[model samples]
Target: MEEKAKSFEELKPMLRPTGVEPGIMKVDPEKCTSCGLCIQNCPFKCLEMDEDEHPKMKSGCVCISCSNCIVACPVDALSIERVYTVKGGFFDTETPAVKMPMPPKDADGTPAEWNEVERVVLERRSVRHYKKKPVPEPLLTRVLEAGRFAPSGGNHQPWKFTVVTDPEFIAELEATLHGFWSGVYPVFNNDETVMNMVGVVETGVFDPRTQYGIRCIALKELPVYLGAPVIVYMGAHTKLNNPALTIGICGQNMNIVANSLGLGACWTNFGAVPLNAMPELKQRLGFGEEWTVVTALVLGYPKFKQFGMVARHYRPVTWFRPGTKTPQTEK
Candidate 1:
């Protein structure tokens, strides 16, 4: 039989010593207004109001050191002190269990050259065209594993990945989304009153750009999901800090891994908005009530080879240094 997952309390005693400092929530009584925002916003429920209405850690409470409570405090009364020593091993080994093969190093054991790594990152393109071949199950698993190791705030790792490889199901999903968009496309061109009514009923505000995209998909002008053989849907808890950004990080990891594995991947928001809107579809696709679809990635072999890095427009950057008279600007 599979072992049952241990609760935090049960695992506390078994925790081993690690040298990393642990963040402990510290509250300044003089600065505190007793607003209880820290307690209310604590994701782990480690904080509770004391008898004096001041926020305090509950008995045997464990903090993940996410510092969410610190951000939630409006009065700047809360801060995280890294005084406590961390207990337990955060990682099993220095190297990842699943990683791409490393390049040969010198006899002195210097770090491997980063040329391959840089090429993977720079040459990866959002492939819109894909070959008809389906991605192998083992390769897909590696892609998912890459995503699983992505960093999240407080190590919450509050994300779920659902993979869809069935051609029939993917076709069904495409049809459903296309139908929904087709039904809603006419409202964009409707008179002001009807459009306003739609905005109120649907998303409170409707962008014409979004409507145009929807129309394109509805009319089959643009491919719904780029005809990729594998689709992975990422969902995260709505209550987590920067959940969408966390999912984006995870998706990028998958994208990079896919590219390294000689596969093409594209991050698409095509399904996210519609998937979340359809409760029945969401349930059918295995997303829980607390979870919201953050993004979707389609993966397959590229139809055509893309070589070299694509040129990107440069943006202005500001740098601050102690000795500098003013901030340095770079373009």
Candidate 2:
């Protein structure tokens, strides 16, 4: 087997981080076109043309890992690398050296502080398998209201929402998704969970006692989008630089609001891609052609209380500390 050499130019595009930064750039000499395309498309203007008219680091620290330049490059020629060994591990791809913007401030324009909100974030969990009951219209409205309040870039507010309340619509949507996924099982057989599902689906032998999991656990077991009786579909204008981010913020807002209201919510993206491909479904959902589905949520009341808080294990607190292995005393 040939060991793959780093085609930094070709592979660099994939390394650009969607967010988070002040990272590294790895370039491949062999695949570099020197067309300066990377420099042209960079959102932060962090890339520049060298004497050879090839893309090179400009300020180096202006990158935010948006990956725009990497994706825009005609020939993949850039990869983000971390200057420090410790910072590289957090990013899925190399991010250009740049700082993430600070979170927004509160209504009084003071830098936002949300101790309660932070607490809610820690408490949130994915809840599936809800008891059969219709979600009330008022509660669904509140969840959507919270989502609409989410901030957007330049306050574009370019989002549309479709709340699937009718059981028939939900059933139809789920059935369509089920068929599509069932067809694609062969291609994804390498995935163990998917492979097992493929085996079951292929058998075509119906066994009522055998529990066949649906696309999303929330979609399968719950009566109303997992028991809250509502599902919210969030769509965004893809022309924006960060549609996904915008939609995600909105989704979180809805989730938090739902939690506060004593409702449970689970986020899912399984429907977005395929749902967009079907024009009829998109139109029925009232989303426009310029709009792309960002995310969806299954919402309902919890059948049982969440398991209480446990120790939060994460990458490491040492990275944020002054030095490695600094002994901690709870402040």
Candidate 3:
């Protein structure tokens, strides 16, 4: 009976949209280089390339509007529509390379300064490989200042940061991180294998947790901090709701600021998994008891720079087009 129950648990259906798994996506064959990126990005295994070097929906598969295929196309060949249809091929909608829309200017023609901000945002990539050089003190301080300037609810600003640069401490941290995950790995997956990861991802049954398990396995081979010289911990311990959002805003500021200064930054919250589970680690870091380690980031010079933009999944969004008479409720 126990084995039967466990088997049933794995067979459960995930509650996403029902009609079509992926909304109608068209691929311009002329533009497609058959890069197979869309196939690589599909979490559900719903896309495959036809013999003629064009992407096609896998046989008898339901489509979801995840937009993974459309966004992964480097050549702007794939597109998606708001409606759900499967008849058209590639000429249905234009799926250009994603870009942040330019915001309108005021009467004085003062353009939004956010163009540069957008460039930094879009260009920012989480770098894992770093050169064996220490980030300059001035640049590091500037990144922290950017983090400190992040806004908080009611202007409370109930956040604190811990910057770790001591080489001995970082080495110990790496060892502790490795030990913690190694022991806890079996709890998530008794049978750790790449095939199991793919199976769990396809079911969408373990959609979020599955990713965590996969990441744990990846971290075992790749150092969680990726040999960076500096780490910044964004933390708070107020008796309020989770400060995850505030810490994220702060960390993002640090990331963009770091990137702008030609330094690479990668967010590594997994470091906290060990710290929170073991109180001694937190104490070692000089943080008070129960201090929620909201985010952890590493900063250093990247070993290799990523030149071109990689396509990302375009999230389905609803835009409100303006009408002559605005709704009274809106104002």
* Predicted model with the maximum lDDT: 1
**lDDT of candidate 2 over 128-231, digit per residue (tens):** 54546777888888888998999988998767898887777777777776666556533333333333343334322111111122212223331223333567
Candidate 3 or 2, higher TM-score: 3
lDDT, candidates in the order shown: 0.70, 0.59, 0.64
Q: Once model 1 is optimally superposed onto the true structure by TM-score, how far is the C-alpha of residue 323 displaced, in angstroms?
A: 1.6
Candidate ranking (TM-score, best to worst): 3, 1, 2
lDDT of 1 at 129: 66
TM-score of each: 0.61, 0.53, 0.62
Alpha carbon lDDT of residue 50, candidate 3? Answer: 92
Q: List per-candidate RMSD values in Å.
A: 22.1, 20.8, 9.1
Which has the higher TM-score value, candidate number 1 or candidate number 2? 1
Candidate 2 residue 110 C-alpha distance from true site, Å: 24
